[model samples]
Target chain A: MKFTILGTGSATPITERRPSAALLDLGNESILLDCGEGTQFQMLKYKVRFSRIKYILITHLHGDHFFGLIALLNTLNNTGRTEPLVLIGPHGLQDIIGVQLRYSLSFLNYTIDYRTTNPGAFEEVFSNEKISISTIPLKHRIPCTGYLISEKPALRKILAERLPPDFPLPYFKMLKEGLDVEHEGKIYANAEYTLAPASPKKVAYCSDTIFDLGIASYVYQADLLYHESTFTKELSARAQMTFHSTAEQAASIAKAAQVKQLIIGHFSSRYKDTSAFLTEAREIFQNTYLSEEGKTFRV
Target chain B: MKFTILGTGSATPITERRPSAALLDLGNESILLDCGEGTQFQMLKYKVRFSRIKYILITHLHGDHFFGLIALLNTLNNTGRTEPLVLIGPHGLQDIIGVQLRYSLSFLNYTIDYRTTNPGAFEEVFSNEKISISTIPLKHRIPCTGYLISEKPALRKILAERLPPDFPLPYFKMLKEGLDVEHEGKIYANAEYTLAPASPKKVAYCSDTIFDLGIASYVYQADLLYHESTFTKELSARAQMTFHSTAEQAASIAKAAQVKQLIIGHFSSRYKDTSAFLTEAREIFQNTYLSEEGKTFRV
Candidate 1:
């Protein structure tokens, strides 16, 4: 799986940086997270295939998080996208988009399935054969929810060299399921011919929230964790008042959750340079990295 | 008066060009016209002072014409603007922006006075000491109205050298108003001491509209006329079907209106090069020019 960071700035309109948006590409599907005001332009600049996006996950209704959604949908319709799309967000998002479309007299050529997420507790919001999505309830001035996406574990691989030359196709399924099979009065042990399946990969995204230790358990053991570090430790008081996290706080959460890698972003417009955030986060979590626009991270 | 072209592309999202938006700067005040998606970013790129923009005129409710308005207003609020703003548009614009703000729980620090326009008739919508704005009814797929901004004529210049050395201070006002004054039984002619005031400068903007001859009278004798040229003459049939005008058609209207100069923009995404549009327009109107993003024209 791979993830691309489209924008990293927060509420304010800063010339140097854009607003919040990210793109996640799993092996079988692609999803967009937190489309901000210029997310469509960023996608165009980054050359993202709009039709390949099957799902869009919005964290909140703030202008910096979901303002670009309506335009993106309109562009998709104008470009002749006929595939079904899923939109998962908090309550009121549907109404916001509905009113805009109604006033503009625009209708989509594709189908949109709207799913409202619960911001009070963790719950599975979406699931498919390849991946599952769950909410990580967050603390903010307004109702907000983060997302946890996990790829489903695949079946074991069969070792061709150890198997018989004329192995029956019916027995191969049993071997992949780690079950011993008996064919023609001969027993074949599953361990001897099959390799162990790899563990499932998980990615957690938490943004626009204050420092909350309660969310660590929900994101525990995630392969990758993207947290908002809107300010530095020097402005911790301001961060608390605004319900935004500092770099140190984000690192502490990542360390406590034992995440493999931590990505910090949503830098405040007051910050001219982000090296201070990286320097502060790396002190607590060695695997911490800063989210850069148009940069992709592999998991 | 100076006019800045912020975006030149049509509805479709293209990497080479942006959607429709423009900025007009009169001597005492500045106004934004048709804020499309990413218009705020374009303003930042062009270094327009957000505080100086006291009025915003939206031509229609199409996504490409006014999608960026809410975000721009939110940013202005976030940046701590306390001055009142005027927004003039169609009937449904206030409701559209109101719902988005309600969902996000965002309130502006400044007061927004919304003025709704009638698309079927010409009427004056805004008037101040510096300029007056009127609607140029347009034909489009949706209810749309273009804007005609005309600067009020300035006071006539006083020729101090032609006046008496001990000219009365109370009579200065009369001289500026081009009124003859009798001082000590001597009649001073108004024409001898006062120069004629320059003619009022006028600018008309018509976008996302079809080729209609009825709009020519409203924009007659305008110093600068900006009309949407979405296609070349080769695709005139497609332009007509889409309710848009071709380059030649826009030039015809400009020539018929006796406008001093014509600026054509809102080029379709299908066009990779715009030289053909200029070439087609100049055949009918020699003073025709193409609107380039970030370029400013003087009237």
Candidate 2:
């Protein structure tokens, strides 16, 4: 599993550092987290295919976090998208989108399965064959929730090298089922013809939240953790005043949670140079990484 | 008198070609025409300062034409702008922004002087010392209107070389009033010390309109004409069906209006390469140019 950072800037309109957004690619499908303004451009720059997206999870109603959603939906309609997509967000999001559609005179060509998130608790929000998503209540000025996407373990992979060049396609499923196949007077043993499935990975996406040790428990032992670090250590007071976290605070959460890797983003527009954030974050967590637009991290 | 092309693509979202938007720079103040999705990024990329923008003129209710407006206003408020902004658009724009503000729980620090455009008329909408804006009725799927901006005649320029080393600042206005400056018993004749004001330039912006010769009368002899060219000659039928103009049709309007220069934009997304549009338009109007992002044209 892999997740790509689409935008890193916080609630401000900075040209280079865009607002909050990220894409979680699960090979066959993708999920969008906190689609901020101009996120489509970031997706385009990253060569993201529109058809691959299956779900969109919005953390809150902040304009920087979800303002681009209506237009994005309209564009999807214009581009002739017919697949039904799922949308999960806080309360009032549906009303906001409904009002925008009425004023803009827009029509949707497909269905939007709406799911509202309960920002007060940490619980399972959605689940499918590919992945299961849970909400992580975040401490912020507004009611907000982060998402934890846990990939489902896959079936065993067929070893292409052990199979004959003309091996029948029907036996691949049998191999995945831990069954041996005999074809054309030859027997292929499942033990030697298949590999075990890779361990399922978990990716946690936290957007716009204050520093709280409670966040560590929600994202505990995640393969990859993306947390908001709106300020540097020098601006910790400002961060707390705005109900946002500093880079050091986010790194501390990663260290406490013991996640495999941590990516910090959602920087405030006050600082043009984000190198200081990385420097401060790395001081607390050794495996800390700064989130950059269009960069993907494997989980 | 300069205008920059911020976006050129029509309703559909394309990675390389953005939607329709333009910036008119009038030295001290700027006016934005048809702000599409991601127009702010275009403004940021082109270095269009927000404080200098005094007015925004939207042509229609299409999402691609004005979806970015509310978010832009929010950003302006976040950046601590207290200056009042003028927004002139369709009937439901104020209500749209109001609903968005109410749902997002956002408060504006600055006032927005809202004005609804009359799509069926050709009359002066706004006037100031620098420019006068008038409406041009356009034929489109929805209620659409174009803008004709006429620059006001400027005061006569003072010839710095003809003045004494310590020429007083108070006499500059007298020189513009065609009077001789009596400084230190020296007579500096206004006729010899001043240059006549350059003729006022006019720019006509026609967005999302079908081919119609009636437009020629409204934009007659404009210094620069920006007309929609959503299709090439090969797609003339599609253009007519969609109420869009072909490149040749835009060039025809330029030729009929006797404009000094023509910049055609709002190109259909189907055509990956726009060279054919330039070739088609240039065939009718030799001075025709393609609207490229960030390129400024002097009127």
- Per lDDT, the best of the predicted structures is 1
Off by over 4 Å in 1: A160-171, B160-171, B182-186
lDDT (Cα, 0-100) at A146 in candidate 1: 94
The digit string of per-residue lDDT tens for model 1 on B1-299 reads: 89999999989988878889999998666999999988898999999989899999999999999889999999999888999999999989999899888888888899998999999878999997778999999999999999999988888889999888998988889988879999999998999888998989999999978999888899999999999999999999999998999999999999999999999999999989999999999999999999999999999
Backbone clashes per model, in order? 0, 0
Q: What tens digits encode model 1's per-residue C-alpha lDDT throughout A1-299?
A: 89899999999887878899999998556899999987889999998888889999999989999888888999999989999999999999998888888888898889999999999889999998789999999999888999999888788899978877898998999898889999888999888888988898999999889999887899999999999999999999999999999999999999999999999999999999999999999999989999999999998
In TM-score terms, which candidate is top?
1
Best by DockQ: 1
What's the lDDT of the predicted structure labeled candidate 1?
0.92
Instruction: Residues B1-299, candidate 2: write the lDDT tens digits.
Output: 89899998888787888888999998888999988877887888888998888899999988889878877888788878899998888788888788778766789999999888899999888887778999999999888999999998888898989787888899999998778889998888889999998889999999989899999999999999999999998889999999999999999999999999999999888988899999999999999999999999988
Model 1 residue A248 lDDT score: 96
